[model samples]
Target chain A: MSGAVLLSLAGCALALLGGLFASSPLSARRYRAAAALAAALIVGGVWWVADPRGDFGHPITAEAVDANGAPVSTVLVLQRDGGRRQVRRLPLRRPVDGAEYALWAALLLGLLGGGLQYRTRDVGPRWLAPALPAAGAGAAAVMFARMGGLESGEAGVRAWLARFEVGAVQSFTVPDLPWSAQPEGTVALGVAAAVAALALASALWTTPRSGGERLIPIGAALAAAAVIWRMIEVGGLPWRPAEGALWAVAGLLAVAGLERSSALRASTLVGAALALAAVALGA
Target chain B: MPRLPRMRGPWATAWAVVASPWTPWALGLWVAAGAALGLVSEPGQHPASGLVLQLPAALLVFALVARDLGASTARLRWAALYAAGLATALVGGWLAGGEAGMAEVGGARPTESYTRTIAGRSAAAHLGAQLGATLSADGAALTLAMKEHHVGEAVLPLDGVREAHIGRWALHLVDVAPGDEPAYARLKLTPRGGGDPIERAVRTGSGAALEDGTQIAVLRLSPDFGRALGPAAQIQVDWEGGSATAWHFVDSPDLDARVGAAPWAIELVEVATEPRLVLGVRRDGPIGVALAGFGVMIAALLGLVFAGRREGRS
Candidate 1:
């Protein structure tokens, strides 16, 4: 591992250890203060190590080869940044190749630490409860928007060709299936929209005094179900869920299941564990 | 106390210990350790490859954690039911194996036309006068030769052609040829920040390494490429951290064929038609068990929520 990766791992470890120490019953005022210092160090370390600007401006070339390693189609991707290029490839395969494990580990550890710290400090302002759900809804909305409309792969290609008098008289006829029949991104879009709306509703109603507090768990459960459904829908052949999708569904379900009885901090720990298992299995 | 409950068995005692409050913390540590070890030992390999042995134990630990977190007996029962359903689905699917899901079973041969419309013209004409186009495979490129009744023929390279504006319409290149061949290509590499253009003429199975450490190789070359019958070349370019193989056509100069983000803009200036075979693919899987499990899990969780509400009211 590079120094940056090592630094990142160190920061994550320190954050987790500090957060756990602060949250423990044996922690004193001084220990909590020390933990706070450690948190600051972690933030600084992350800021220093993480590449915020990212690997941009580089050209990317993608080639699809047949079984014999013959080039079927080679695409030269220019002008677009690396991040955008990866997003375009999301539908086909894993966007990140190596070091994905480290990235995920850092993310999980950071979240675990933050959750522990947040619990020790008590639930923040009333508005904070809705913040995460609203962000999730926003993210879902963005994903839906990015995916655009679902198109029949062959039909779309043929339509373009027909204008050129190509494929105009072909004997091959692909049934113009209805929108519901197009499973590509249609199911994912529908589920995303549904979950987004539910999350928005939960964000709006989850408050200490609000009678709609139950909406939190309800929204979480529905999101989990929607994610799981999308996984099954998109998983080709053997029906294996994508690693990212598995982690998401596991975390959402753990939250929905444990949020009623356990404190948010405890639930975070459980969710993290389940998320780990989900990611490992999918990997 | 009235013959007190008979001393519990060894298994019962062990179960009690396993379900104790401290068990979750211990399990959490164990999971963390496992994850850390996996990360350190084998970074990129699938976790299941190395950690499959620990899955059952991990599941048991998860159950303990759930119980310790105060999940009710009813909720636990529901979770157990869902797990059983999932297990049944997996087992049954394994036993009845032969690809249970939907898949594209057939394809059709479609008559495709390639035509160009002149600007400000209402009529669109095919490149060939007789409306006949023949697609021939030469190496890695597919050459589309349109037969013109009036004069010379219009030969278009279909392989490695990205965007070709024939009149007002822009046609994108789709699929190329199958298999590999040595490329015979002429390349132009322009440095991103403006430097001397490096030009090289490479034939099939040969390569040239630049001073800047960029390796260019002619990986595949079409037969009759010099004669311009769908002349094309597949060039492989490798830099420090990345490599890309781009298809180049002799006819189309506007084709942007570069792979990956490299410092140099490598252009391959080197290098078809048929009724496109359109495949109608339908994909299906043995998802019945999984779906059932999901439904059960969701229903059970919702039931738990409602039950809690009812209990609160009482």
Candidate 2:
């Protein structure tokens, strides 16, 4: 297994544990401590396993050439000294992998919702308050399903190449761009930061409500839609940071205004608009 | 009583101005104008010079957002809802039309998408170098593009191509049209000299004949089958039970034709996005951005309306 896979598994474990303990009858200090632990594990795990070159067997670099044995000018050869034992095959993994991003997304959403956890004035179902975070976590599975097995995409590419070559078989690794280099993740991150900063300023105009109960169904719906959109492969993951959060938060806020909906009309209109924007961006 | 004497300074004026909504509007207009000017300005010597323009756009957005920021319940919910709408529209529209989005490049037909394919074996070595330029789609047309300014274009009108591998990367244009069937297929030669790729009407009838001197690459099938056409012509690619895209490369413009050789065909496959959607998205991106911007502006307006109400009540 690639380190990315291991890291994601570890993150999932820690995050779940933190969520469980943070909401328990424990002291606020303990809750904060568990949350802190989860955050550290997630960050440390991603950093430790971030390198793609870490997966190769015994670092033997070879010259990449064409069928005619001519040197193509697109790439420059780089050598790295391998210090570890060789593995013949391994799973492709990345720290900024869709799955990892989904987990991180969950954490971010949880952080946003944590304000609901502070007891002081009054409280509604705190358990229900995790609706958005839970939805974010569920969205990861949808992303994985949408991305599909790495090999399947490679196979699709390979099959296409077979049409042109004389005796072509799989010769090189499929191009798996490094996580930091992927535009979607990078753009999403920047947008998320900007939006959150904006929210810190303007969100103060809003009020908090105890009706976390209503969000559960909406979150569930989002998770389902995420899977469907990924399955279609048109473009864009349903729960990407900027677009998904925008829609999710809007849905919650709109629903909050009616103390319910004026029916489901208001919520549906905003929800539909947000969904269109998200999907269209992927295209 | 103590503050009464100090309310006369420029500082007080500045405070009053800052608290007014007009401050945000003025700053917003200035920033918007800067962004528009940046778009019109000449490209800077250093690529980062263009950021001089973008900085103002960002500042405008920040100023507008932060100016109205508060901790009140009304502000938070309304703002979050509006901001969400704003973000979606902006990113989505940007993806469709702006520099950030796919730049639509197609010949006369003018589509949001053009099928991307790679041809020739030597294209891969410099795949990394050409990737940026290739992605720009500046020189992109109907044909598959290669490194440098070289282009490898094949016009297979009747026979649909499933995939193609240029030297750069694998690309597939899988159009698994409903009726998948394989019959006789042949592709003409474009002679690799940039004239026109050989053409063949995609026919799905059985029994194909391979004449001598037919230049064919039989990868899955045996080279011995090269000599005998009638019996060895049966080919099935894994993509479908048989081929729907069969072309008889008829007027061979002399492509690697070998003597005493039988011609057998291979299935075409590779990597690429859906051809139709690409064009549509590229075209629609800008429109989406504008519409989204308007939507967000409306929300902000509503927030203002609520703010006005709150002030009146207070």
Candidate 3:
């Protein structure tokens, strides 16, 4: 079996065992300690199996030449398990802009806030709670503006725009603000504004009941929207989600499910299942 | 306050250290120092070094949180799962070799095109040219076909020519002849305006400035003066306060090579290019494992939160 499939199978088994343990009413302290030890050992075993030195995957480098023996290309061949070989194309141009950095910052803030929320007592003053998410959303907005709106000069945006009824024009001209005319940009700006407004309101008016519970998911949703927009702008039409986007969605779903559900075990199972799906899709 | 029984041995010492109020602060400082060092250093030097430094801190924090929250076995199990997932992610990243690094395949040429391979995927540069590369099924062999000779193209907007009624003036490449120098391209330039069309023979790297302040210079001639591939010229048009370069391929006239942010569009047609396909792999870390770890962490954290809430209510 392929490494990803094998890992997934192992994950499924572990998750099932965890679920059974969670549901069982065994009250013996020794039994509980033994289960935890076994779990730790299982995790170590999985890691050992996945080690690169094992038979999972390895890298191979080779050079290619034309009929005249002139070097034309160099190729890096990776041998995956099950002897499956596939040729894939990577994008040559990777445009990094302020929006991408802003999204990353926002993701980090959301995660930090989530971690803080898990603490027994509040880590900081009350105002700091909402301010964190607010700052994240504000940063995203500022960066989006700095990037000359959503439709700056990316080819992906132009190609996506071409699909619309707006003739063969290279770009849409919005006299003063260039990004106002693009639908994606407008929606993204709206989402960012809304998230910021909500966070600000929470900060000034009322204390959040569940701390970062609502804020993290909303911030994640905003980040996810930006990631999806980036995917469209980079990959163009028939866009495929990149690995980063897949992980962002996985994290969002997992956190949201855990926060919303009452039963911890059921929520964990759902989160694990979603994570497995993300892995399968990303792989 | 009632005194508790004094504990001894290695396990007790470890517990005492973990329970110390200064422990989290010290670990936090260590994390901050590592992060600061990582930020000051150049990226890709040791991409995972920062993460590696923070791993021990994370483990300690996890332990402290578990003890503080009085987490049950199930919650501890989930936390272990989360740690395992994170370790797996770290291993995946270590295996992938961190960020992408470029390796020069061959020496530089007059014009070189590049191709990249990421995670077994390949893509050619957007040069309006083609480079063929293939990999064998056995993951053993790869073949690349390089073009020996190819045509080049370029386009120039007439409106930016500076001369009055220049928009009405049409410039055409009448002919390309061989010159004494291999790099020289002898070109016949015909400009049709209100008056009769003026025909002039312009050598490569040299062009005449019209009565207007407009200056045209032939920047480069691709594939030499006269070769199997049709002659391609890199032409620069400089007027009053602005300058633009365009490519003209004698073979392909329809190629739109206009790029950059300018009021008036200049079409740089096509040019001969010897493309070298260089494949580089950018490992964005083990995203799947990291994400799985994140999910497990969230699940474990939720369990702890629920437990804490229940204890508070009681």
Clashes of 2: 49
Q: Give one digit per residue, the lDDT tens place, for model 2 in B1-314.
A: 01223456897786566534444344433432332222222211113322433343333333334434443556545545554554554455345332211213322222222222123111112222222112112222234343556434322221121222233222322221211122224444333224444443222222333333333332222111332211122222222122222222212223234321223233221111112212111111223443454355445535644554575467
Candidate 1 chain A, poorest ten consecutive residues by summed lDDT: A85-94
lDDT-wise, the better of 2 and 3 is 3
lDDT of 2 by residue, A1-283 (tens): 1222122222222222222332223222222222322232222222222222322122112122233322211111112244321211112222234444554665566454434433332244433433433344345434533442222245533433453442322132343331111212222222222222222222222233322223322332232233222312322211122222232222322222222212222222222222222222221
- Per-residue lDDT tens digits of candidate 1, residues B214-286? 8888787663344423446777878898887876654354454233366677666533111231111112234
What 10-residue stretch in candidate 3 chain A is worst by lDDT?
A: A234-243
TM-score of each: 0.37, 0.26, 0.34
Cα RMSD (Å) between model 1 and the true structure? Answer: 21.3
How many steric clashes between backbone atoms does each model show? 36, 49, 23
| DockQ measured for candidate 3 | 0.02
lDDT of 3 at B53: 48
lDDT of 1 by residue, A199-255 (tens): 224333432231232433343345345534443433321212232223233333333
* Cα lDDT over the full model 3: 0.34
The regions of model 2 sitting more than 4 angstroms off are A1-190, A199-283, B1-186, B190-201, B206-256, B260-314
